[model samples]
Target: MSVHHSVSTHHHGGSGAGWLALFLVLSLLLLGLVVAIATAIGDYAIGLDTVFLAVTNGLGLTGADISPIEQSVVWDLRLSRALVAALSGAGLAICGAILQALLRNPLAEPFVLGVSAGASTGAVCVIVLGIGGGGLSLSMGAFTGAFSAFALVAILSNGATSGPNHTILAGVAAAQLFNALTSYIVTTSGNAQQARDVMFWLLGSFGGVRWPDFHLLIIVVVLGLGVCLYMARALDAFTFGDEDAAALGVPVARIRLVLFALTAMITATIVSMVGAIGFVGLVVPHAARYVVGPMHLRLLPASAAIGAVFMVLADIASRVIVSQQTVPIGVVTALVGVPFFALILYRSRPQT
Candidate 1:
């Protein structure tokens, strides 16, 4: 009887693994399709066939005959933008999953640590105060500001020893401080044109991303994913709360620190490049968790894949939603996220 029970458990585990693998493969294929669609659409309106050939040609996988203009539009512009959007989405979602696990709060997200607020303040400084004196780019300034915010959070939370609540409170404080600074800089120092640019960027746009941006983002996302996957077991332990995680010999403080820094790094990179896009981190993980059943090993990858697909679709929406003008990617995400956010709140509310 015991042997039979063991066999049944093993069979169940194997079946679950197979399903997870299938989900990942399907999600990735869906992401690829969405990316192709994103590259194909826009004012120029290339077909999927052209989009494929152009991509294959750029990748040196094929020497398909394609016009230079179409090739450039597909390969040089839209493909890079779509890829960056996918990666940014993946990275943000992973960060969200990590933070939500470590902090034990379903509402927790990458930006809850104030990384986005800090990046915005940094970009504003570069844009308005001329802090870099034309040498410092907005991305660099934002990256610096983001790290600074993380550092401040670390100080306030006392390196995760103070617990998740304190860390969250610290993040809130950091966000408020940085947001106030950003507003002050924009209102007091920046010109009308500068303020307009700042506002658009703050809302998020993929229009400016190119190959270089994609290259940087891919590296960050890959590294973040690798590190997070290595610590997946630890994240799973964290879901039971910090004290329980420590009781499980999970090195609670150390894991929390590493995760906090990793999340800040990933979030800062996305925000600096893409201009503080919101809600992917907040929404994607919850959806992924619902599907994958909250095991970090499964949940993390699921979140990343879902996030990539979601962001590319959001980017497509942003382009077509307004006819001619490109809507801010952040705005598109918020429009989708707000309803989901309300749903989560409604569901998670205390029992009557």
Candidate 2:
């Protein structure tokens, strides 16, 4: 009977792995399709064929007769933008999934946990206040601020012993404090032009991203994903709560610290580059979880692919939503995420 049970379990695992492989392939195809569509959109629309030709031309695969301007737009401006959007989405969604599992809170995300707010404050300090005597890059400042906020949350929550609610409340307080700091810096220190730039960045924009940004972001997201996957078993253990995980011989405290730091690093890098774009983290993980189930190994990659697709689509919507003006990417995401957020809240509410 035991041998029969073992054989059945192995067969079931194999079947599940096959399904996951199929899902991942489909997700990648969908992501590629949307990224292509994103490249083909903009102020001066290019044909999809031209988009493909431009890409191939840039790669020296086939030097088709494409206009210099069209090639530049496709290869230089829009393609990088779309790729960065995809990477940002994947990174944010991964962070969200990791956070949700670690915190065991469906709503746990960088935005909700004040990591984004902290990073924003840090970024504005470098941009407006000239912190670090102009030596500090925005990314580093944001990283410092993000880590600070995570540390503060830990202090307030008393190292996870106070439970998820207490940690959430601590996050609320951290967010308010950091947001207030950002407002004060902008209002008192920044000139009109500086204020405008800072405000626009705060709202989020993919306008400035280029190949260099993509190169950096890709590294961060890939490393972060790898690290999370390495710790997938621990994350699964975390879903059962800390005591239970510890009882299972997991070093709960150490794992929590490392994962929290990783989350801060990814959140800060993205926030510094593109500002605080919320809800990708909040919304994408739930959608991925619904399709892929709760296993971190499957869920992480699914979230990354789904998120890449979602953000590229959102970027396209941002460009075309208004006649000439591009809406902030944050606004587009909020429109979708707010409704989902409300639904989750209503469902998670205590029953009478």
Q: Which candidate is the best by TM-score?
A: 1
Give the Cα-based TM-score of candidate 1 against the true structure: 0.95
Q: Which ten residues in a row have the lowest lDDT in candidate 2?
A: 2-11
Candidate 1 Cα lDDT to native: 0.90
* C-alpha lDDT (0 to 100) for residue 80 of candidate 2: 94
Local accuracy of candidate 1 as per-residue lDDT tens digits, 1-352: 4322432343336677788899999999999999999999999999999999998999999999989999999998999999999999999999999999888888889789998999999999998999979999989999999999999989988877887788899999999999999999999998999999999999999988889888888998999899999998778777767776776678988888888888888888888888989899999999997887777788899999999999999999999999989999999999999999999899888997
Listed per model in order, the count of residue pairs whose N, CA or C atoms clash below 3 Å is 0, 0
Question: Where is model 1 more than 4 Å wrong at Cα?
Answer: 1-12
| Residue 116, candidate 2: alpha-carbon lDDT | 89
